[model samples]
Target chain A: MTAQAAQADQLASSHGHLVIIGGGEDKERDMAILKRFVELCGGPSAKIVVVTAASAVCARMWETYDRAFRDLGVTRHVHLHLMTRHDANDEDLIRDVLDADGIFMTGGDQKRLLAIIGGTALDAEMHAALKLRGACIGGTSAGASAMSGHMLAQGRAELHPEKGSVSLGAGLGFLHKVVIDQHFSERQRLSRLLSVVAQNPYLQGIGIDEDTALVVERGVGIEVVGEGAVTIVDGRAMSTNVAEIADHATPELIDVRLHLLPAGSRYGLPGADDRDARRIPPPLLEFLENITKRNPIS
Target chain B: MTAQAAQADQLASSHGHLVIIGGGEDKERDMAILKRFVELCGGPSAKIVVVTAASAVCARMWETYDRAFRDLGVTRHVHLHLMTRHDANDEDLIRDVLDADGIFMTGGDQKRLLAIIGGTALDAEMHAALKLRGACIGGTSAGASAMSGHMLAQGRAELHPEKGSVSLGAGLGFLHKVVIDQHFSERQRLSRLLSVVAQNPYLQGIGIDEDTALVVERGVGIEVVGEGAVTIVDGRAMSTNVAEIADHATPELIDVRLHLLPAGSRYGLPGADDRDARRIPPPLLEFLENITKRNPIS
Candidate 1:
């Protein structure tokens, strides 16, 4: 385990689960990501709160998600959008967070999410729901980006690991030592995520491709869901010359480990009682080996 | 102390000092803030590094500070600006952080600073220099905002406390729990600051007017310097209907304590050896009392 990741807390709340969907989940097709989300909310009977605070068109976002969840058999659904900071501190809004079994954040801008709900009473309440009430909190795209403690606020889709490629902000901070990038492959965000990891070696970067999700079950492990792949960049033991490069020069990275997780594969995060050092499951290891055999980078 | 602040680290590392300057510091007249920074770095003999990563006109910023430091009689000076992530990872840049007696950040865009140098080797070096090497690290304007762990990335100078007025991001994070706002009175950022405090009750808000500075000594206390006032907004006991206000309606703030300290006033922080409960010095207290008597808001 890496130094920081070893000390970093689990992505899941133990009592709750986290579904971070890379934007563009197949809503019109298999709807696998959304279906899994609803199922994780204890299936249909869950009281789900759809937060469209991040969306520019909140009402439309709510309508679309409401319809999707309803189709997935979710009976109790509510829409809570913050038009301003005032709404973030409302008692009713906080109550909504407390009462939610599943809290879903829609895509728009991560900055909007932080501005509207970052550290307000409603923010406290949402955390309370996740930690205390065991509510499953999830989001997509900008929503997914807001889950990390050190959030990636904005950045261009640079192909090279150069400086000024990304800007980070404080997220809802659901997870630590991990930075998430949405629409990973589709948006060509690999270099962005790499830049993030290169800056903070202790951090483990996870880039989720479109139509995919990285499901974190606190203290258990992470599972990839949907059609695309989940890329994990581990830089704990890596060596890099990120400190001495020129203005436009690409950074040189060595010993950085990359893991590709497809649907149905499981990678374990060491839990409180996690023993037997090998955290990777045998099946997951076998899959990695096969993939390694198929395409050797070195 | 507020819950989060109770755990928040001191603004100054135990080994170093912190000088956060509001924007437009007087480079022409007294230059008291700059003088203090220089003095803290052990005077004219100190080797100083000025980081202009935040500025768009990097060369101009470097030239301005270079002249100021020279006027202050500092012989050795270096300029380090990360034009790209590569520069941030440069070994020479890291060495400069280690070798410098004082490191100063210039005013520009806080977001730009984060984009160029937020998490790179240079960021790590800056932190290391302060914490381990006992080098005094300081900044002005956008530089000041970046000192806080939870930085106020951008915000409008609204006269009333309202939502959607500001966006918070990840700062250099030399300090925690406390948020700093530069060009406070000049920009009329009271409502903006109030909104910040309301959203994050755990954070103490420091709004420094232009030409002024807040000097924080680790585990010791803070002192005001320069021409203008430093507005300290303590919302630990304040109550707000922020969780339930309308979109444009001003937030009703109750029980919030505001302290306005002019130059030469010393405020006490609860250090490890802070024995007495009374933190405010008797003279400072008298000043506050006199001001309160002069202007009774209630």
Candidate 2:
């Protein structure tokens, strides 16, 4: 495990559960990811606040999700469409979000969503609801991308990694240790994700495939759900020849550990107690062991 | 004073002092800023370590700083020139930095310095040295720019603020509440600084002029020194008409409080005791009162 993960583990496990879903989650079929979100939010009586700021079709998106939640038996839910910054600071709206059992953000443009809500009174209250009140926070697509403190704002997809291809921006900061990217397999965004991880080795990169979701119990564990798998890119023990690369050029990364986790599998996050029990892939183990031997702490 | 400053004031006032100097500091004439840095490091008996990773001419810069410190009567010092990531993880190098009385990072390219030292054992030790050992830390130019958690990597200087003009990157993170911009007046970076503040209103913008330095005694107060004035941009209660602006367009910010402090002036940072004594600029006072009245907490 990386030192950061260990440090995260040491933090008090009091923060709320984060249901971060990739784009195109199965809402009509089983609604498995949404179901888990509702379950975590106290089921039928869940006071869910749907944030549709990211979507261009805010009203229609809200109506669709409102019906989906109602179909899943969620009786108490509110739609919050923050078109402007003023909407974010609405005292009544802030109070509603603060009192919510679950706050879910829908998909569209992550930048637009953040531009409206980032650093506002509503943003502060959303953080408080999750950290202090243990309210379940969920997001999909652009919403999912906005979950991390350092977000993948926009980037081009490619098989080979290129420097300066992926652009990063400030997110809502619900997650601090990792960078999240959605529609992984659907868009072939491995290159962009790798570029981001290469640039920022301290941050772990999690690429969630379309229809998949990672249920993160902050400072504890992550459980994968939905139709596909989650790609865990560990750059902690990575060795990259990025210095040799020129500006806007492709970077060469060596020994970056990649873990493919399918649905139903649970993985220990930074602060998990049973970290040793989860088997490390051979390549990752070898890489980590080499790093430990080379850089032993006195 | 902003809420962040108030929170910073509440923190234990036990952290070390930070001598963050803007570019073009008067090293030859009087050497006032460097002398203050040396004094903060416990005077002549100070064990100072000079990090020249930012400079392309690392050896030359080290020798020049070495002579300056020596002329100021600092007897014990070491030079750290990290060209690669391996040098950043070097145990001996890490030990030297951690054991130093003061750690000074010279100017060059902030990205190069951060890319080499960021997320390494050396980076961790640097933080520990400042937080745990109370070791006075000093940085100039690019070094000063890299002191904040959110850094302004690259941008153009314009009279009007553009949305996508300024590019940001992760810094060494010694300072968390504000974003530092160096050579402020010389480069005409007010537009970019305002743009950044508009995008991320949670962070206050600090523009340090050439030959000026902001001496931050963490968790206590900030004292400006040298020839020019330091421009303080508070965006906490700012109202921006950014939603109306298109992509890569200029943003209009209203109610952003700007404070100009010349050398010898002191301002209470977060956790400061005599906050009330430091007169709030009339406009800022009116803005704060309006916010308090509008957003009254129950």
Candidate 3:
């Protein structure tokens, strides 16, 4: 695909706001995201749909949602579960979610969530609602990590960035360019994030600390929210021994230069922005202009 | 690197059994791995270096080691904190780890471990120790994920075996030609693993379940240990999907024929046993051989 098309694709939006909260037991932080979630859902009175994919709070999830919706004054709240093959095509659940204004994925193991919904009818519907219908999508912890194209599962839990510490898994790819790592600082996972970036030089990695959230606006790019800093690892500028290393031998020594961007800063990737800081690059700017003028693919 | 040569390189020293475990907070499981680790260390009395890059349990990692070592009747135990920039290259730590007969990494956040030690002086030394000195290197969860060449960071968390849910990152590459995912069954991450192999059509993907270990016998291949099954996602015999689709708008979908190999089965990519039915074909064997022998710079 051409760089222009890539930018245009990134700019297309069927949703108002996408929020990814880092994992932790921060009710206050969660509430902030929930508030935005409600706003994106078309206000406190808007109907809401919540999906508890990888949550340990299984039976209690619906009750929790009931409380949240009641406290927020939402007109309606529905909880959907896709744990089995049959659940993949639950028409009622899909309809509720698609018709709702906001969809939220609860935290647990993202892998579990993906396994149950991936390639299923519900997954297709969910994508359609978010991509075509402009529905708000939000998640926390594993849910947050699942929103990006690249998701950090587990890394070799070491203090240093090693060749194999950062393990990758599948994510939702809602935000295509960035990979998200949760419980970042509280867990001290900088090395894993860096190692992850080093693995996929094509991706720009973001590590959101606990209590933090990354607010991604379709065309505008990412903004950070919450109590902690969001560490960003841009591998585009990295120089490495990856290409030069001999096969099977430990990779040769190389230093990676990293950029730590907290919430609120907007950055663009290669071809997406002008090299000069003064003006928007012609290529990306044109692409964005196209997105604004033409109808989205959905 | 002829298969023979690669064998020679791995066989050059003991390197013992390279055991990588997925994440879980099970003491019994940890104890079992510890037992294996001690055996790999050559004896309880043998000086064993325990590195807790994965676990924040560094402060008490030694106690765990001591308890295990003492229970095993092995005396000499060295616990080091290799979590910071300086600690990663602590001259004494490196020398101790290199000098020791066994090297173990605790579980916590593999990303942290990778960051500080990756491409550092200590990393090189440790690899040398493993390759030339026959040291046993063990890790769990994030540690297990880091063992492969293609590490799965975060990708799309969909259950579809499509090209998006999983993203590939640079892994330790100790086991080239393989991509790893941890906590497989419990997390229901099969689709992500399948999609990862689909993108990397040539590589073999191994999904290790919690409390499970993949004992890779260098040239001989892998043996699964622990309670759960090691899901092996092999795309070597896979069929392509380009023609099935109408346009490039659809990313490649993998009709991955998955094999869930339980603990105890041996896996050798293609050339391991001269095409035995029992082993998965090591697709990269030929390419790996050619690359090694010719040493192609380009």
Give the best candidate by DockQ.
3
Separate DockQ for every predicted complex: 0.01, 0.01, 0.02
Q: Which ten residues in a row have the lowest lDDT in candidate 1 chain B?
A: B289-298
Model 2 stretches with alpha carbons more than 4 Å out:
A1-298, B1-14, B269-298
**Top candidate when judged by lDDT against the true structure:** 2
Say which prediction, candidate 1 or candidate 2, comes out ahead on lDDT.
2
- iRMS per model, in Å, is 26.3, 24.3, 18.5
Q: How does candidate 1 fare on TM-score? A: 0.45
Measured against the true structure, the TM-scores of the candidates, in listed sequence, are 0.45, 0.45, 0.44
Per-candidate alpha-carbon RMSD to the true structure: 22.3, 23.0, 16.5
Task: Report every candidate's CA lDDT.
Answer: 0.73, 0.74, 0.60
Candidate 1, residues A8-88: lDDT per residue as tens digits?
Answer: 222233456789999998776679999988777766777789999999999999989988888887788899978998988
- Model 2, residue pairs in steric clash: A9-A271, B5-B270, B8-B270, B8-B271, B9-B270, B9-B271, B9-B272, B10-B271
| Model 2 lDDT, full chain set | 0.74
Clashes of each: 14, 8, 74
